[model samples]
Target: MIWPFNRKTSTETGAEYYIRDAAIADAKTLVDFKHRIWRDMFGHLKDEAFFTQAEATTDEQVKFWQSRISRGDTVWMAEDLRDRLVGTLHATTKHSEHTAEFVAAHALGELHELRYFYLTAATAETTIGTELIRTAIGDQPAITWLMGHAPLVETNLRQAGFEPLGEPIDPSDAPWKGIPRQAMVRQ
Candidate 1:
């Protein structure tokens, strides 16, 4: 968590967990966290109709995360005091074309995409999520996909200066087919 509620500090506090850059060794843990949180956020991941291309390939997710880390895009993982995975934050230079178009239409300039910032249900009300976000993007302008299912997260983003753009960024793949995703931007 962000100790003393200081966004300026990046050091781990004497809280429940600490955040750090994800390493290659963390692939499996990271993948597991993604699935668990997906279930927490989206509920129908196991329904099979929503698709599993991404879910079916743990190795691909690992490689994708490794690529993000190697490319130095913002990818941070949170671990509890016992060193167990608890949360994650990823901001990427890569985003959907719709996001790009909306940014261009509004003249928002270059902005990183806050791909996903997830904290387990246990850490939801804590400062760890905020810490991860501040560490990942600081005060830089950025965009992100907000789950309509997560009101508190959206509220936090709004407080951080992100607002919904256009109608909503349409889901491109099967995995995201039924989930409502809005492109929130900060210029």
Candidate 2:
């Protein structure tokens, strides 16, 4: 449903937009938003070959978001006054196996890298990205592994009390062929 921007609702104030859990029905919208954001954020990252191949396709993104929702992960989105989703956050519940192994790798006696958090690019002024990170962190204090990259992602992550753990790492696990993916971690 298109959220009325100026209309008063329990979800948000008139002056600003708000965030909510993404639904299966939002698949198409999410895909479109994803394409736009990716094109903007990574359009200039590498060679044209990489850009063309890694470009966001509607079908691919829809399937991805659908899978994320079906897997029980939550996708939070921010709608502008026009009811358009300008920003998005995708997060999975705290990891068990990875966190345990990470602790061992780091040699920490007791470590808790709770959940993994990610955000999509949109208008920088809205601060929706920042709010999404904050909300997720607030909901799950155990989340210790927030992940993202880019200058904006770093800024938002820092605002949420996350520290720079290291350089960004590629997020794509499959042989997607051309699109390059990278992510930064915060604890």
Candidate 3:
């Protein structure tokens, strides 16, 4: 469902981007958004090999998103006037295999997970992310991981009553590990 730009939603007003449900065809665009987020997050390091490795997983990433969207996960996306995807909030009552491992590791039970929340730099500081978060998860108790680099996300999570879950850890798996992320849970 595409949200009309001029229409005001319960959570936000004057938003430059419209929030909508993502379709299966959006899998590639979601993958591209992931790449853009990674670029903004790590490009300044100028790590060519890391980016090359990330590129190697593009098809796999696209497929993963396709599966998620098809299965009714990660359903929310924010788009601009031109219909370009600017942001998304991946929240679900179910967990992915790796995320289930994370929940097990953290001893979290009976909680939804906000796996990935990304917005282009332009929208990063706007209310769009907050609106998406509220719309997707509401006051439901849930868990989320935020990279240390995204102060805006951290702030938004904090505003939504999410507190630090544990010590910071690098979320990346082997072969590419440099980020220090914090886990938070709304309790």
Candidate 4:
């Protein structure tokens, strides 16, 4: 059963888990989740000091989330039965095709950018990832283009009908750091 796209609580799990468009009030949670997940997952890629120095917080992430959500973008969360948010996935509609260096040059102009979706380590397999992606791209079934950072879990997405495109791209401008991201398109 699909929950309301604007609410975050779920009835069956009593976990308050739901995928809905994020709001300004969700900023702190979003930021905390991002930081926590990063420390938990990407700690080996770079120094934990960077994240600390970056001073990234839920309020900041929320501000960005609020801006995007306010502009037709959506962010989904996986909360516990106790209403504690555990993970998040952020997706936005791109007006223009996003060109990634790894994409076949010929296919660049033909794709739509279903950008940015992530799940917390603890909430990774709770079906939150699949649910969030479905919420974002389900209705527009024909627009079969999406991408994200998850080489380790590519198979899960593949099973869901998303095929890996090419190598992943760096989500930031920092030249010293890079993450292994995987891209997918509908087959």
Q: Highest lDDT, which number?
A: 3
Model 2 residue-pair collision total: 3
- Per-residue lDDT for 92-158 in model 3, tens only? 7777675577778877787888966887766756778778888898888888877636766777788
Q: What is the lDDT of residue 96 in candidate 4?
A: 30
Q: Where is model 3 poorest over a 10-residue stretch in terms of lDDT?
A: 6-15
List clashing residue pairs in candidate 1.
none
Give the candidate order by descending TM-score.
3, 1, 4, 2
Ranking by lDDT: 3, 1, 2, 4
lDDT of 1 by residue, 110-139 (tens): 898887677666676777766777888888
Better of 3 and 4 by TM-score: 3
RMSD of each: 6.1, 5.7, 4.9, 6.4
Instruction: Give the CA lDDT, 0 to 100, for residue 97 in model 2.
Output: 68
- If both were scored by lDDT, which would come out higher, candidate 3 or candidate 4? 3
Predicted structure 3: lDDT: 0.76
Q: After superposition, how far is residue 97 of candidate 2 from its true place, in Å?
A: 10
